[model samples]
Target: MVGRQITWISSWKPQRRTTTSNGRTPRYSHWVRYNTFYGLVFTTTLATLLLMADLIEWRATGYLFVLANRFPGTVALIVQLLAAFFGLIHVAVVCRLINYALRLRLRKASVTLDVLRTWVDMSIPRIDWDLPLRFFFPVLLVVFLSLVPAALWAGSITPFIDRTTTTGMLLLPSYEDVSLIREYPMEIGTSGPSLRTQKGFFTYSVGVQHVGNLLSSAASASSSTTGKRLVHPKLDNTQFSYIGRSYGVGAPAGLTDMSISSNSQVAGYIYQEEGYLCNVTCIYNRTSAFRLRGPVAEWIYEASGNLPDSVDSGEMSAYIGHTGDAIVAIGVAHSERSPRRYLALAAGPSYAFLNSTQCALDFTPHLFNVTVDIANLNISVVPANPIPDFNPQRNLTRTVMRQFELLSNDLTNLYVSLLGDALNASIAAYNMSRPPNAGRDPVSVSEEAATLAGLTNSITAMADDMLAAYASAQLMVGKTFTQKRDVQVYLYGLQFGQRVYIYAIFVFNLLVLGAVAGEAVRTRGWRELGRFNYLDPRDLVIAASRGGEGVAWAADGLARRHSKKKKGAGEKRKSMKHVWLLSDPDEGNGSLSIRMKGDGEGHVGIVVRSPLFPPSPDPEKGERGGGGGGGFEDGGDAVDADKRAAQREWDRRRRQKQRVGLFGSM
Candidate 1:
């Protein structure tokens, strides 16, 4: 191949013999073809540029002008529309041709005299012009039909974004409404080590347990008592990425605060100490902790509404467990007819962490008020107690429970507002201000910015009104924010018609392209069938795994059965095998747990294993196992079961990693 390539190169080189002391002369035909092709390319390119500029100007000003004033009449409109259509078609044809020629050149031979000569000879002056005619004719027909009065039917059209906007939600009336309602529930993946799974959920992250080691002296008098050995689950020594790690109070006593540092996904935290809650503020990233060293403390006093027995002009001091501790202070409002009763929750090492937790807590609560009865409070605790070694276990429980109750109520109310009528009203009001427009319209940046600014101002004003309503409610119920509300506002406004037009265009283009492709396939037969042969090579492994026999039984979907047969002598009739099926057991108390290596380094799973396994001969093996493996009296070794569980975890992690890697590459 190298020799052939060398020979080819030698032959292809321009000959010096034909150009003795002078450059070779250009052929007239070559010059003519090159000029003609480039002239066409240049003209098409100029037309495309002009069309784009015109469209943009039209969108900006909501007015179309081609060389000054051209009034809106069917004739002038039709001509302009036709020109735009043909111009777009011209671009498509040129682009496709360029792509095809480049591919051909790269895959076949380089530029050659024979190839150039053939292109010139075979080229038809009007052949590339077919696309313009095709695009223009259909557009012209549509325009003419549209102008007919009969075509203007009065059909109600659903707004475009309605498809993306989830339904059955009540919109929040205001920011204070957000505080009153709960945010909707979003599926959150959990993380951590030493977490156990039961009924499909992993329950732990940085699991905290108080350990007391007591040394007993030799007994003298009556009878001697030996201390029983205490045991606690070992923490998993795995630290996944911040996106996977779950943060909790490392220590419950001292200045126990949990915050996300700057370098990590966690931003900051505010936590409780062992004594009277101290509210100190600080800024932090990942590595270092900076005290709210700001001359002014970042602390806000929350009113407990009780005058201390020792009164030294005490304001509503936040119960910070100890001095110099940072915690999130959130107001919780419950409703009878109107949302009234309020409670404040404080627990954090930094504001950011507190805010995020507050947001997470608020999600479910905010949504509930919007959709259901505000009086109904359902709390699902993520059972991770703060570091219990420093603080008395009893005090820790009370503080944690109080914090959870207050936070849960706030979160629920926030979620309810987001999903309730308030959101719907907001969307409706937003859409009403601006309707969509189709017909190859153009947009202007300055005009759009002005419109957006006006909308933003209006939304701000509305939000303030909402806050006032909440404040009034708070006062009536006897409570308020200690450091006035500094609420962050977000506003969304979308043009309905334009979005619809774009969506319709996309769907129409897809259908038309598919039809064009089908027609092209029919016209060309199967000559280019090799183009679709590409595959990932990973999918094959997935398929094989699914196809394998003796796949792990999950007691869901397809069921497996054992076959039994009777052996007989040659003279006797042969007995056929009968399949014995084990029906999937009903949902029972028995559980199945699954843990993955990279997935928060913890376990997550559902329980479906049955309690019907017969007792094993080895009693030690039967009761020595844990969870699902121990539910049945199987004589399986504990280590072996653990190994199997670990392997399953590894598989799950591998699959998750593969998915993430694939998406990243995309």
Candidate 2:
């Protein structure tokens, strides 16, 4: 085509189709009722939504939790009511089917009008207790029974469903590499590491953990465990402008709030490095292999500096004073020649006789358990144990001995005394009240050894807290700190009881769907047209006042019963039951009316066989026996022609009613 230079159509569009049509109007005939259609829609939709909700439950923290950071129980309850509204619609359809079954002819149908009224009210979801239908429908009972429990679930499920998020859950964390965990922060994030040098000494500021260890028994008990020099429970952490890092046991970093919702109170925790904890074990009343040195033999009575005073005596003791006359005493053990230094606690309050029992502190490593509560980051540290190695490059034994070395002498007793006292006050002896008189009491050797064993456990817990504080602070240093490792934390999610309610709602809707669908299917070909289908005031009045005569007795019986009169058998609301269907005696030609006969004293026959589906009339049968079928017609004067005309009209009415569908429209 290019060589021949032929003209070709570039674009061809399809012809537009016309929506307008010119033909006879058509009427739609639905096989199922409108209420039934709505019910099916609601039930199936709710089921799908429930399944979807369950599948994505873990992620609902950011989505469905719109109203409050906390679980919105009121919102959930409101949503449940909204879903139940659809079930209410289906229930209405079910009530209609039940009414048809109760009033069916070709069988006895003698229910009181009050029973009908009660069921109609129940369809609207009321507390009306109709005695007749009470035991008939189990599904109806569920609505009443579940009310109280459903309300309780709405209120209680919030706290029950509190949950944690980890790597396995929907939202996962990216942990910073902790390969540089060997590095330690010597000071808080603010101070420098260098000591001012002079010929006398290279004087430097000690790290927080060192200064914290120097606190008295009571002060160190609370402060040192949290890496503070003072016991300040309300101490605020550093914000973004200035980072705060603890050298002992405290929050390493106070991170910016990263919660998904402003209302959400999310808490997170991360893993930290292993810590070197001091555990003391001593054999009470045991003799030592080594004797005291020449210079250490004579004990001096010195006043207690910063170390704790004896709680019973309420006075300070010297760091190395003889146990008999000292507030706190210290005794150096096997210090003459040993690679690992050991401090003994045999010295009493005055003369090699501190009241404290014999104990030796040993260093060990354990995993740290650190917790960080954010949305306002709060830190908490718990014990780490189960005896394992932390693989440290630095020996905590040597570092601790040097840090607490006696400044005046080569003695190493003062360090262990403070460490033991701090832990003993808080955990080992655990007498926060400092109850007195136990010191004077005699104790067995086993009791003495048992006392030191308690100190071992205390050291393990305190060490873990210290490690958590140290490792977290390393991250906040922003200088030498390098890595972080991910850990599990608590996050908002669904609870077991909450899930149970959701599944229960799904199942309830299924029951409603099945009930309504079953009723619709059973009556697909049958529709009660005319006044038989309605229960409104106008319809009930027309049925009661059959043809042109008023239902004067019905109104009179209600009044008379309340008036305290001795009424006749058929003059009460309960006594009047008889009703029969007949050709509309009103102006309308092809309608039906249910009427009471002679104040309901006369019994009536009920026929439920549809007029359209009635058996074909045989010519041999006497079909034209009744003539001029209006009430009290003159049968004797009727001719054969008028009788035939009446039968012919009845046949046409029957054909018209047959064309109606379940929804009562052609």
TM-score of each: 0.16, 0.54
Worst 10 residues of 2 by lDDT: 1-10
Error of 2 at 516 (Å): 2.9
lDDT of 1: 0.24
lDDT of 2 by residue, 330-350 (tens): 333212123233433433333
lDDT per residue, candidate 1, 1-666, as tens digits?
101111111122322213222222221233432232343343334334434433342221112222213343543455445434533443333333333342223222222212222222222111211122323243344334333211111000111111111112111112222232222122244321122222111211111111010000000100111232111111111111111111121111011011112111121222211111211111112321111221133332232321111123222333222332343333322112222222222333332232211111110111110011111211111222223233222222222222322322222221131111222233334333443441234652333333233323222222222222222222222223111211111111111223333333334334434543564466342121111000212422332232221112322111111111112243453332211123332221111111101011111111121121111122333433223332221223447666456435534543342211100111
Where does the lowest 10-residue lDDT sum fall in candidate 1? 213-222
| Candidate 1 TM-score over all chains jointly | 0.16
**Which candidate number maximizes lDDT?**
2
lDDT of 2: 0.36
What is the RMSD of candidate 1? 39.1
Segments in model 1 whose C-alpha atoms lie over 4 Å from true places? 1-87, 90-492, 496-499, 525-666
| Number of clashes found in candidate 1 | 79
Task: Please list the Cα RMSD from the true structure of every candidate, rounded to 1 decimal place.
Answer: 39.1, 15.5
